[model samples]
Target: MEWAEFTEQSHKGRASWTAIQPENKRTATDNALALKEFFQRFPEYQNRKFYITGSFTSESYGGVYVPTLTNLVIKMIQNGTLPNVKLVGMAVGNGELSADQQTNSAVDLLYYRGMLGMQQFDSLKSCCVDNYDQPLTYCNFSQFVVVDDFGNLSPNNNTNDPKAIQCGKLITSFAMDSVWATANDVYNSYQDCYNFTSLSSGGLKGEAGRRTWKAIMGSKRLRASVQQSQDLQSMFSTGSNPFVDQGALYNQGSTDAMGGFACYMDSATQVYLNLPQVRKALHIPDSLPPWVDCNIPVNSQYYHQQNHDMTPVFQSIIDSGYHLNMLIYNGDVDMACNFLGDEWFMENLAGSVYKFNLLSDRFAWNYTRGSFLPQLGGYVKSWSNYNTTSIDLLTVKGAGHFVPTDRPGPALQMIYNFMHTGNYNNSVPFSLDPQPLLPQFAAPPKPSFTRKQADRVWSLPGVTYELNFKQYSGYLNGVPGNYLHYW
Candidate 1:
């Protein structure tokens, strides 16, 4: 679709793209027709099988559109409208399938990660009924702190009650405030936040730095209010903002470094995509607006014409008897579309919806990097419908919202295994037999390098050392400056 046709100027003077609207049923039919046209143009490849993969919001779209497209193509083939096209399966990573599950699981994740106080967690669980479905009059999970568009923080409705104010501060400190403040890089908690100033100032440099910046820019999105704060009315109403809301993302702090693997203030991707040469290569017209990670107008103006819960669509595909396989994977550390909620969704599908027999108990999957020993990559659970269909729910340990960027080796191995073996086990070659030990050598003399040189060496990228003894080292507060000392 052309960019102009995909997006339109809204009455609010914003560009709204219809392509990514969650409830846009026309997208499926369009996609199916596009596929039909593709086969018509290239009849020789009609017998080829295809598999689909999507991440984040695209994953949600895939959940609905992929199956719908498949069904449409099957009908077309039966009716002699189009040639036969085989869809083998699909894979979704950190997908936002159910708003209820995603929203509730985020709170649970906060509590589990020690980001919420015990009392506050208990209160939320009791009052909100373990979810965000309760009305504000009954339970105000986010009522503690109310932030405005100008980054001003105040008590909810400017309440002067002492308890309310304290609760607000507590929630702000624990839930909202982090390394990136309001734009708290919810995708990955442990990653360092970056900005254009930092990047341009040579704080991050060299090819390694450029790669890191590219990865961050490519993954980040303008995810303001898109991750949370959906009202019941909007969720059910058509032509309403079911995805994006006027809640936390805007009110908190700067959304400059919003989406992606880490929080970043600027998008290198936007800069690159807008370049004249790049635009010419991609055939982007000059009349289109400059590129952005996420279309804010589209997010706010999208219609929820389709079912939010996509389990039925998935179940329909499985029952279609197309020898289908589905892989629903999540990064364990991702709070947006959390692993727990996705796990629950898959478990419910297997146990109740499909009545599929459990093929494997949840077990640790390992991955290796460089010469490092095999480490726990994540956990996996599998379900099978005899031999016709299979579903696997897997988690990538220590990964954030973007699993491929977070754990590239593991992610590649996982997808490779899924395509071939239909499971995560034995993704890479492994051997139980022990190899011959190397001959012992004399220990090297203590280094004569200066402390600065040692620091430089230690800070070098991709450097790892095997130490004989455990060493504890950390930064310490000082009068004028912090001290980095080892004990």
Candidate 2:
């Protein structure tokens, strides 16, 4: 689709789509049809079994929410945004793409946004429909990550920079084209240079774009699924009574039913008598009870159970085919669609791909405490019985809410390796493994504060009580243990 047409469809009633993400939005037939046509026009990805990936496929529909650390867009190398990347033209020096064709080629991302699991579509619907509500302003900027290209199906030991490798340029280039509200003259035209604060102000990416444009275009919507979860969980207090009211209302207010004031739970009516004014007394508002005002980000356990609603449709796609495989990549640091959340998702997924460790040069450790035990932030697998369907939850080291941003190299290699081996590669650690051992520090001038373990065999005399003479060798408040070893 041309950038102009892309802008038209993005705001036209279906006011919620971001052009470069893989979020699968439930869309009207016309838009879906248009998407299919757009992909058909692209020579590189027209056919040959296409599989889409990104945040859009998994994001919950809602209003203009902020971009949690999980918004993969910032991590993904969007086209010309990276060094030596070929946008509309080509890799500047590599001459891989022509400048004239780069813009059009990158614009193809607008198509990818429409093509992949249709996350952008779902996000669009949520923005324009599902989450429509008057908020701080009639104007709003909704930020939703539709698709993520973080290498779930990364290729093998192929160590080539993913950007320079096959399919890399194409995907990133499209991502670049998808940005209009922030950059690009094409999107700027529709933006009409509508000026407003960046979406980051509300602690969000403003996926909808400039406030001026959003207000003029229409009210942005949030996905109903996530909104529902947030709504329900928000009502419960961690306090004594998790719920204020349910089914029916009962009152034990002044009446201590059994001498001691016992909150009544009507098994039949499912109402609570302990609540101040039971449902029996109030005019039950049409919406959630007035007492529900809590914040439950998707990353919280409150919203943890909601992901089951987001099982990727692509899972079935892999099962439907024979010689194919699919992977679901997640960055652990993403507070929203975090690594742990993905882990929980995989645990629930019924599959047969073998589960194992990611052996990389990065930090690796096994914790003895089960609850506090971290996966050391690496990959764990969920595979299919026939070796086709698989989901590998790859954890990033020291990564917070966003993996690509902090550990882009590992994320990139993960995808590269996935594409290389249709199965998990236990050999590749998260990084170079520090195999040479960081130069050893010439014996550290001491033994790393001492590995001597306290129980050492002393061959010398019993006067063993050595003195530091006031200052000396080993580690102590100021004194060295070695000084104590002196006679």
Candidate 3:
């Protein structure tokens, strides 16, 4: 906890909670060992079990490139350079494992998911007991708020009651704009459900930045949760509504009622990746420019780059004694990487690098049994070093910011009981059989103008084709101060 008591008790300042990546020519440990030498030059990826992920922890490029390419593929299987790289465990859902312990657990996880309600959680708990004498859950506020199964209060529930001196002047104006802004009210109240209106300039990831990047390339709950039930009943035969909104990630206005359910999953994933038998069953390769789900110039180059504090490369990969199992999950309506800031970053890296006697206390994992529905599935805390390396720190119940797209069956039974039998104890009853294959990608190139290089013109006066571009291949003029798109 000592980075000056985690920056004056989670005021989260000295920056660096993970960014600085913009170079892109390559290097995130050389694109994770060039994707483990393209899956060890494929042979149906032999003994496979490789799972590695990182979705948003701020202007992502898989925030810290998926945990520095899963610690350089566990330092190439502890030096033998990928000795059969089984690498069974590493999960980061909700990224940023520590930007000041997730900006001190995103202002008490938006006031325990009431959305800073209980009168702004008692005015940020009496402005942290009158300026740091302590309490507002010791300024980090920790976790709890569960209420879902349709009873409501789950759209990332930024706790609510609204008043503690206007929630201490809206948490000191979002901690003066970045202790990551106390987890930015869990992404403006649960995945941009709404409430951002300041717009004279840009902040909150530049409000409506490029129409929320063309409404997340037409998001439909991220393209019908990856299709297939008769191709999602013949491409949604009147069922598509992953929360009807398409202002793309926020700034919906005009009395914002609906617009930004990842913009209809980025416009039905550009017609399910330009169909044609799903691009010949995912081979793609026609040319390359259409599917775009939030790429405003690589999220404006990780939102104007430069950031770091990777908590000493996460305490040099758990004090590098290396054995690694680390899970560190979260979703309790994630305000992007919130699980009380990775449970105070594994209780401040188990009392600052193991000396604090291999910690372990917080528990409760619950499930109740329902292969596809029941869940409490949250709360856990573990840490060990004596037995080489361990760390759990979990939470998933109800979820948000994509914990397998919000609780995909308790996030696949808590990742198949923490990767086949390491059992993270959710009081048993998880049951797994036939549920894992959703990571397929391959189909993306083919746009440089087709259907007769389509064109048509009209300047305004109730515009016709909104200016030009008849078919597909780009060049959409739309004149007037010119808004081009030359394919």
Candidate 4:
């Protein structure tokens, strides 16, 4: 299924295209209709139950679209328009459900992380109080700090003008740093930045290069342009901004689509996807514009006419009487949508929505890696409405914006357990090794590679272990003069 054309187009460009065309509005309902049409075309899968999931901006979209789609499906089923199409539940990671709450918590996270000094933080508290719903001019905190081009922040020693120190540029500086600086990755703070020059000079090659690329790309952060940073500042300036109005917060510019914070493997992925053969294999039409990770034009034209606060939508679903589950997970270190903000949203929902009761105290979930002992994966808190519905809020401890990419093992375990058991519990240890053999069964043959050349390429450096699987690489025909490489 596809989003409205304007929404898709806005994501491709850097500027707002539909700002001039106010009448050209788009919302989740359009996508719901498309999904309904898709189900109609395939009657055989009409009654199948499905779970929805999304990350980042898509997560934000899911908060609105999923419920809308769910209600639409319910109506269809009631009217016999669709025999059946079950909407079991949904999961969202680092979602922007409430912009005001997220922005406020993002600043608070930075302060807690030592990004802000006690004096500066005190000053901010004094000026803006705990609430960030005031005008930008009224709560300017940036004047007290100095932010360099590299995104580094320090106290402004030039002067101590009380008016200047209100609350102006601190968030703006951090926002810019998240986009251009290497030290502050808004996605996964612990991951290394991928240097484009290194890739071009063959610094990353072979299996080692592939591993490095995977690590970098797996934890890659989203990039917003300087203008986008300014837009964020404007968003803070205007209290209670909606995600749609603040395009820069989610939309990716050309450079962002090309790589992301450090140009990670997206550059290569873009090249590979645009390859003539690859596009043809994917059935992409020649007339369509080149594929990009995000389309700025689509973001610019998009509109959410519905209430910005999605609490009502969620409450409506819970009241709908259908058994459902919802999981809102966040990577603790992500500035884009910090865990604190989501925690606040969930807490508010639990208090305001009917039938929800605290089911479990917040507890640590753990995961085991290789031969190492189990480690803290994250923390989880849950609420339930008897046996009919459930909601959970979780945080992946050291991860940033991209939970799965930043902490794949923990993410996989958390998601798997949640999907199967309807809760995030890692009490039982998980293992990768096969189960012990039965007394009657014969032992399997020792794994071995027949080809020496292939073995050499696939061999892990400094490791001594028997393999259960083989690895291979190949080259594919690209756009006439070029070729695509894959492992």
Give the best candidate by TM-score. Answer: 1
- Model 3 lDDT per residue over 273-302, tens place: 877788767776768565544444544334
Name the better of 3 and 4 by TM-score: 4
lDDT of 4 by residue, 1-487 (tens): 1121113422212223434432111333454556577777876666566665643323433454555555555555556765666666677787756544554565566666776666655545544554444422223344455533211334455766654443434444342232223345555554444332221113754333333332342233333222223233222111333335545445342233212433344555667799999999989999998976544344324432243446766766666676878788888876655677778778878756564788887998777666768888889888887767788888887776766655666777787777666545443356544345585653454243333333234566676997778665544456886767666
Candidate 2 lDDT tens digits, 126-217: 23333444221111111111221211111122445442243333332233323322322221111111121122214323322232222211
Better of 1 and 4 by lDDT: 1
Q: State candidate 2's TM-score.
A: 0.29
Q: TM per model?
A: 0.59, 0.29, 0.29, 0.58
Clashes of each: 3, 77, 41, 24
Alpha-carbon RMSD, each predicted model: 18.4, 27.4, 22.0, 18.4
Candidate 3 lDDT at 348 equals 66
Query: Residue 245 lDDT in model 3?
Result: 37
- TM-score-sorted candidate list, best first: 1, 4, 2, 3
Q: Which stretches of candidate 2 lie over 4 Å from their true place?
A: 1-25, 28-35, 43-49, 55-308, 311-324, 351-377, 423-487
- In order, candidate lDDTs are 0.55, 0.29, 0.48, 0.54
* Whole-model lDDT, model 4: 0.54
